[model samples]
Target: MPIQLAHAATLPAHADSVFLLPAGTTQLPAQLADLHEASRKYVTEQLAADSKLITVNHYSHRHYFVVASAKGSAHLIAEAMRKSGHQLHALLKADKVTELYVEDLSESADGALALALAEGIYLSAYEFEGYKTDEKSKKPAALTRVLLTGAASAEAIQELDYLLQGVCLARDLINAPLNKLNATQFAERMAEAGDAAGYQTEIFDLPRIEALRMGGLLAVNLGSPEPPTFTIMEWKPENARNSQPYVLVGKGVVFDTGGLSLKPTPGSMDMMKCDMSGGAAVTGVLYALAKNKVPIHVIGLVPATDNRPGGMAYVPGDVLTMYSGLTVEVLNTDAEGRLILADALAFAKKYEPALVVDIATLTGSAARAIGKEGIVGMGTADEVQLLALKQAGNRVHERVVEFPLWDEYAEHIKSDIADINNLGKAEAGAISAGKFLERFTEGTPWIHLDIAGPAYLTAPDSYRGKGGTGTSVRLLYDFLKNQE
Candidate 1:
């Protein structure tokens, strides 16, 4: 929730708490005195006592402005709020401090806004309490409302909403367990979300999949009773005219049991639900854009399926034809994300998008290269688009460290039977995976985000919760907004 404050007359005279100040208002002499005195007391007396300056306001329905100890304090507050099941937006509206400006705080205002917004999302995120036995106690709180104050123009608020929707969508998708959100159910969820967001959505079932000859999707679905689905969501601005569409393709491997190359029992088989993080990321961004009404034409494609080892599961060394009609020699059934994405990437040519960006938790090599931070690899010979992506990455703090697509790496995919092989050697796995995807782009400006590292969380942090990190949503959102 964006913070809001009550009228001055309604606030307590001696509350002595640092009330949030909205952005852009000149402080009155009395208000300034109160803030000054509170800061000093907290710094000197409170620090010495080792006591927190917690504001205990209950009577007022709206939040009152109190200076945060620091910008990071908002995140701390959000963590506490999450545990207590209190919506920060309710307090923000009550406090009337959506846009805060403290002369003493040196943090960048924009960065603070980003942090505050992300923290709010963390606090408002829903957990799957559906199957709990203690029905009464297990009911989760609803953080449905938000209020932003200060010099927030309509456009700024829209942008904020755009980002929030992205985060919330990702959280919902990630929080759902495999039983409830398999490949088919996930496609329905995306379709529903798209419909609600005013985007045109189309889902390709088994018949259409066969018609289109999406062999990778079909191959992956063979082990499961549920058929594969390829979903596409299109968003066109009312005011937009003949602008180049931005195509986003995501790998929706809902549960990857590695097919015939099944993972060990010690490995996290259940967490495979999040294997579709790349698809979720793109879907969330599209939802955000529609919610905020961002004036850009976008098409989001997700090739959804589950890869389980069963009687019909594709085996190693199997050759499958993608939508591009380019045959792939599958050397490792576990290396499936790129196989799905290749079909989507090939289909991207229909839109003739000026830029195509696909995201996937493609390889552990990406995690090794950049750790929990994301590593971005683009394969457009166009230097200008590459530089723009790099700049966009830096500005949004979804910092992308680029890896080269040298000719040497291309040789790894050369196959004796088919045009290309799905799996290369384990060495340089991340680069080879990205290089594998570049083959289908057909020279269109493209970027492949290997977000395996940042997509899931091993621990909780200020900006995100444990489970889904909602990686790459804001970075792409910011890039599209900039394009507008």
Candidate 2:
């Protein structure tokens, strides 16, 4: 989507949709009588009758203003909107209408303006067109432009631009159909995007896997026809030429069929395309960091693969050696994310980063624990880093709640034939999964995000849509910016 700036009067003539701030129920004084009457009778009156409390109808050119009453005292709603086909304006090709908007905005002078710009771009760029055909469209084209009502300073503009870039990259990755976005292809796309965004990149094929003896990755790739790939992205700011890097690892499971263990019919295998959301998330983060020219040294490690029940798929009772030389007994083939991440975590350790953070759509138990509102995380050390992530998440509305990685949980993975097992017993499944990955982190200050719930959404709300939520990108961006 393209971002544009315009004066309030010129906006109505140029935009397919116009957003406005309506006067409050008791706030607008009687002196501005005529203007207040138009706002209250037309806008607030309509909003009060609806439950979603979102859209307010306007007869002129099908424009709508989203409003809410609150303390901050500005009518910017939320900083989000979107355009969809078959809407009133789309039917006439009068340019796409802004489909979503927020009300009750902050009046703070810092990040508020930029956030508003980002909100507009984000709310307007979403589409869910993958499954339907009989109707005009289940999805819509990308939002190509946005018309803003206020002056966004240069710094605010840059911040908003980078935020939108992160969101767009995530939307593109999640919005892709499964057939086009498996492991190898994802790596290729990231490489291309990295090149264009000015980051140094490299990819590891199956041969390199064998050379490096990345047994965990090799074991997971035994099923799919598409080969597995490991991708590395590096960004060193001009000023940080001598500093050690901050590393991030993301689990890149493109499609998970639960391997030989398999999944249930009601499991919704079709949405597995979004299983690589963590990878897409980090990829988006890298794009933003570079595009915004953040003065920091960074490295991103992605271990990519597919888990299918092929003829030679790794099966139950199989023992696999990992890059860390630790052997894992595959008690359940469906428990495959930790196996792949073990190799990637070990690989990241060599860089000796100031910190290592890995994000994965690892466990459904996490969803059960934290629901769809926040990310569930477990860090081996550094309470401060974890707390900082929590604060950042809370501010962005992408929250993270940390769990304990108790050494006692390792008892579940204790195996007679190998060093450990991929998964523990069904109880405490989320924490045990974190324990499994913790083994591979050695002693680094690390945070493991089991983003099973927040990674995908079934409906649109706030600034997020019904598909991939791109859950952690914004929080990660916020945290990184703090170090600077």
Candidate 3:
């Protein structure tokens, strides 16, 4: 359930409490100072005992006095608060406390602190129960309402809420089983979300996709019973910030059975449904920008389908012509994300975008290299745009590690039979995949984000939740929000 947010003139009685405290101090807000003198003493003593204490004090009325260590840069502080929010959610659910009153008593009670706390609490409270048969008995977090004071404006709070909603939407799409969310259905959901968020949406069916001669997409979808879909979502306010739109391309492999190059039963194929996480992240960003009414012209392109080893699936030796009429040698059918994304990147040229960023769970090499800690980014985009994206990633705690997209790596993907090969040598696999997509950019400044490392989490990590982390939504949203 979504948590409701409201501005509280005074802390309401009977609501659970969360206090943000700066490091090395026990000072409380004026409203809470005299009311909880004993609690303050206890917290001070606890802080004295443990220099790294971020403790929670439970008292009567289901109140929790959370003292977080606020002693770092704004980005680091926001990350700490996010983790603290996760802990607070656990405590609230354990004690059956629903309503939370959060007051930032930190020495720095600025908008950044307030927004960080809210983002943490609200994001941590998200629970996806779409297929939980025993959801009622399990009783996920009971946090229903959050009353905030001395932090951000109501408008800012509302924007955060919308952003979280977008993240949750991405999570939901990524977590859904392939049976529930196929290519056509995913495109329909995108249209529905665009409608709700006041954006323009257009979906190209298999026939329409064929009309455009999107051979890469069609080649990848030849195996699945379900048809492929190409979704285009645009958010262009009348007073947009950019003259040309910023284009986002997402690889939407709904499920990857690896075609003829089949993955092992239990190991590689288990989480294939998350293959579309890149597409989900793109939709999430669009939802956030449109819902918040960010004044920017942005376009999202998603090429979606499942890769199965059934009828007429493209073979490893096959040479397929892409949307740009470039031929690609299918060295490995499992290397299909780049094939579809190549077509989308080629198609994005029609828009003449100011900048293009294509995100994909395209390589296991990236995941193995980074180990789910950060996204692997490489591109030929302007240095300024690259720096802004890196800063945005840091701000959202979805950090990016840049790899070189040098011409040297392009040789690895050179094909004897075609323009390029789908798979490269074992070494620097991620860089070679970026090189493959770079061929389709048509000289446009483009960035490739390989999110295989961070998009889908198998275990809970802080407020990122259990399954889908919705990794790039916040990162891209922050980037778009800060665009001049």
Candidate 4:
């Protein structure tokens, strides 16, 4: 269930309190003015010392103070507030405290700090316990109600709420195992999200996909029993800011076994259930934007399937035709993400998109190149557009590291038997993969996001818990919100 968020004119006496204080504080805000003089002094001392990253919880008085220190860059400080928000949720859950009154007195510009903190608090509250049969053992949601009296405006809070809903939706889809969320079910989930979030959903079954001749998607699905689906979700409000739609394509390999080139079970195949995270994020961003009535014409494309070693799996040295009539020689079945995404990117050109962003848990090389700190980005978009995206990533703390998409890199994928090859040279695999996708783009402004490292986690990292971090939804949302 969604948490209840409300606004109060002043401080409420009955609920547990969370106070946001600026760094180097000599005095408490008006709301905290009533704190015992000695306790206030102690809190001020802690803020000045600047050692505690998130908070100074006065357990005795049931007071929790979150610090907004300028110890790092602006983005880092916003992240500190967000992580502190996660800490707030953890603390409340630990004490079984349900109700919270947040007084955001950080006084940062445009209430950015408060909004970031709210994002942390809300996003950290997501939990997926569906498989837990033992009702008592499952960790259910504890923080259900939050009241705010702060610099963060009510409108901003509502937008944050919708955006977080989209993000958690992505997390849920990613966390669901293969048995429950196969290709067909993934399409259904996308349709359901579209229905709820006021977007238009059109799902193409296998026959329709064949009718459209999406050969790359079909070639990848040759090995699996389950049929593939090409899902299109669109949101085009009457007042859309742009003349052309922005297209987002996501790779939706619901599960991957590397097909003919099978992966070892212990590590490689174990986490493949989350292979569809990129699709989930596209669905999420659409949901959030539509719900917020962002007035942007956006179309989301997802090509979903599972790659298994059933009969007739496409093997290396075989050539396949893609949706664009481009022939790609299959060098490695594990390199299937680019194949499926290539088809989606080709399909996107029908819309004459102003910008196209394809996000995927595409390559292990990307994961090894930058282990979970940021996303690997390389695309045909110009410097101004890329800079905007980088800034957006910084604001949301899901940073992007750009790789060179030089013409020289394209030579790695040239094939003897076909127009191109799916697998590139081992070195710079991530960039080469981006270069491969760039072929399908055919010059429409494009950006490729390789979210392999950060999309799923082995350990709980701050608010982004163990499974499916819902990596880039917030970053994409921030980027799109500033598209005008």
The lDDT per prediction is 0.69, 0.71, 0.86, 0.88
lDDT of 2 by residue, 1-484 (tens): 3433222323333224533333243233242243335655655455555411223334443444433324332322332212211121233233445432211132334425334534544444455445566666544454444434444444655665666677667767877765878878899889987887788889999899889999988998898888899999988878764366888898888888888888876565767777788888889888888887788888998999889999688889999999999999999988888888889898898998888899888998999988997899887758787788887776566778888888899898899999999988889999998888888988787889888998887776445667887778887887887774
Number of the predicted model whose lDDT against the real structure is largest: 4
Residue 19 in candidate 1, Cα distance off native in Å: 4.6
Per-residue alpha-carbon lDDT of model 1 for 1-484, expressed as tens digits? 2222111213334432233333232332243454455444444443344332223343432222322333234434433323322233344335543332212121335434424443443334434344667757753333433333333334554556566667668767866777888878989999898887888889888899999998878887878777889999999988654378999998899888888888776565767778998889888898988887778899999999888888688999899988888899989889999989999999998898989999898998888888886555657747776676766666555677788888899888889999999987768888899889888997688888888888887676444557776788877887776674
lDDT per residue (tens digit) for residues 1-484 in model 3: 7887666766766556776666555444465555566666766676666533343444656544555554677788778877777777776777777787877666554556656766777888888867756756676458788877775677877888899999999999999999999999999999999999999999999889999999899999999999999999999999898998999999899999999999998978999999999999999999999999999999999999999889999999999988999999999999999999999999999999898999899999999999888999989888899999999998999999999988899899999989999999999999999999999996899999999988888788878878888889999999988997
Where does the lowest 10-residue lDDT sum fall in candidate 1? 1-10
User: What is the C-alpha local distance difference test score of candidate 4?
Assistant: 0.88
Clashes of each: 19, 10, 0, 0
**Pairs in clash, predicted candidate 2:** 77-102, 77-103, 78-102, 78-103, 79-119, 80-119, 81-123, 81-124, 82-123, 82-124
Sort the candidates on TM-score, descending order. 4, 3, 2, 1
Off by over 4 Å in 2: 1-106, 111-114, 117-121, 128-143, 149-151
Clash list (residue pairs), candidate 3 = none
Error of 3 at 404 (Å): 0.3
